[model samples]
Target: MRCDNGPELISAALGEWCEVQVIVLHWIQLGKPTQNAYVERFNGSFRRKVLNAYLFATLRQVRHLLTE
Candidate 1:
């Protein structure tokens, strides 16, 4: 999977899980958002479809809506 240099995605826990699953997690260079185009596109789609279409007062509510 290709992703940005976010702390959560670069954490040891996620690294361990990827190792266990034999998956390679590649991070794009800092300040280079275009390198992670797929994630950016998905995020844009998600924002348009879910975020912009709702008004959630809490993080939990957002998470719940996403899971749905």
Candidate 2:
């Protein structure tokens, strides 16, 4: 199981489906841009797909999107 610690919904469910190892990367450690390629790309994707779509109406909206 590999995921960004950002999503608690997914992080909270780690190791729940069969036997697996969870690797959560730190933000600074991840900034190196080489520890992981695909995961880093996906991180950019979520930021674009989910974050770019919404026109934030208030601070709460930005907070809400980050949580999801």
Global lDDT of each model? Answer: 0.89, 0.59
Backbone atom clashes (below 3 Å) for every candidate:
0, 0
Top candidate (TM-score):
1
lDDT value for model 1: 0.89
Span of 10 residues, lowest total lDDT, candidate 2:
17-26
lDDT tens per residue, model 1, 1-68? 88888786878999899999999988889999999887789999999999899998999999898788
Per-residue lDDT of 1-68 in model 2, one digit per residue for the tens? 33443455344355453234445434424345555568779878988887677788799988887788
Considering only N, C-alpha and C atoms within 3 Å, which residue pairs clash in candidate 2? none
For model 1 the local lDDT of residue 10 reads 74
Q: Mind sharing the TM-score for model 2? A: 0.34
In model 2, the runs with Cα more than 4 Å from the true position are 1-32, 36-39, 66-68
RMSD score of candidate 1 (Å): 3.1
Residue 6 of model 2: what lDDT? 48
